[model samples]
Target: MGTYRYRVQTSGFGLFLGIAAEATRLTNPPTMNVPVSNRVWLDASEVNNAFHGNRLALNEREVAWLRVGLDKVSGDIERIETSPYILISVRALEIFEVDYAEEALAPAIAGWATREFTLTPRLCNVSRDSDTGQFTFDWNE
Candidate 1:
């Protein structure tokens, strides 16, 4: 099976942060690997037409509602074999600290992958080298 990676960007004030923070508090955060009931592939043309230049803003409640809708429409989506990890810059946002955001968003991003691709994703820690000013991913697999 082929592995896929998708990057999702969300504002700091959305439900994504709230849900993700709660999930990170768990000893072993929840993972999803549900099988798709109805197989329906996404049409690239349609997706692009719908979201190409539009900015879709959704709150926590709206996100939950959208998940339900996605579950119904994207049942036939492909599954991810490998556990995808998240990479966030340490200095990305001023309001949200990198350490906290890393902990919160890792599982959140993984959950997103699981929901969309029917696979359990992993949270990998990111480190920056002081000398080289480069970032490295430590896949805690």
Candidate 2:
């Protein structure tokens, strides 16, 4: 009924990847029937690479949800050049919309959506003088 949350597709914070899976790709009711968008190909190799040797920051329910999404993504990419990869953050809103009405899932989904996507500062190295407030940047080539 209100704004949907937990929508970021990349790995950062706001919503843990595992939690996002439960809200979007792994909702028990299967709320997505439309074509998915905003998704990037995520292969098993990449998944392993991302979490290799590290404990996935998800609980059992979240892990199960992630598995559902991974399975769907794996199937979707099979016939395309991007086969063997699954999509993340694809149809985030659509998926959320379908399940947002549920009482138990709504709060968690909303919280995850609150996470912001951040970009590394791209400007050249910078420095400032303490006394004069003068600024300098290397901008070296």
Candidate 3:
């Protein structure tokens, strides 16, 4: 065919321990197998936490400096506010190579191969496949 659109995966935006589940892990792992189009998700986190952990290590001198200036920060868990996630359905052209004469108008993987999605903290959840028993499939953008 020319091009096709599939409901790769549907995720529910939620949070886990202040961290969106999808933030830690997306239904479709960010890789070639999993295309950016497959990044379908919905903002379902009304009470989402979306917490992230950051580190600021300090040496003895640094600690002493911070102590001197009262710039020391120590705590158990830090709370970070992140954006919500939305459920989205993705469809891409499955690249089919025929010959130099003919080419399909599907998801193309030519010069542009690698891609990235700037996902804030948001719990994205997609149920595993029941028939094939797959959490999700792989795609590329």
Write down the TM-score of every candidate: 0.25, 0.23, 0.16
C-alpha RMSD by candidate, in order: 15.5, 17.2, 22.6
Clashing pairs in 1: 39-76, 40-76
Is 2 or 3 the stronger prediction by TM-score? 2
Across residues 1-141, which tens digit of lDDT does each residue of candidate 2 receive? 123343322222122122332222332222332223333232121122122443333334533433333333333333332322223342223223332222222233323333311212122333445587443434232
lDDT of 1 by residue, 1-141 (tens): 122222334332222132211111122212431221222211111111121334334334433432432343232232322222211101111122332323333334334435435554454455555587443445464
lDDT of all predictions, in order shown? 0.30, 0.30, 0.21
Please write out the lDDT profile of model 3 over residues 1-141, one tens digit for every residue: 022121222253211111111222343333322122223222212312112232323234422321221111110001121222212111222211222101111111110111112212222223454576433312210
Q: Model 1: number of clashes? A: 2
Runs of candidate 1 with Cα error greater than 4 angstroms are 1-112
Best of the two (1, 3) by lDDT: 1
| CA lDDT for candidate 1 | 0.30
* Model 2: how far residue 41 lies from native, Å: 11
* Stretch of 10 with least lDDT, candidate 2: 40-49
What global local distance difference test value does model 2 have?
Answer: 0.30
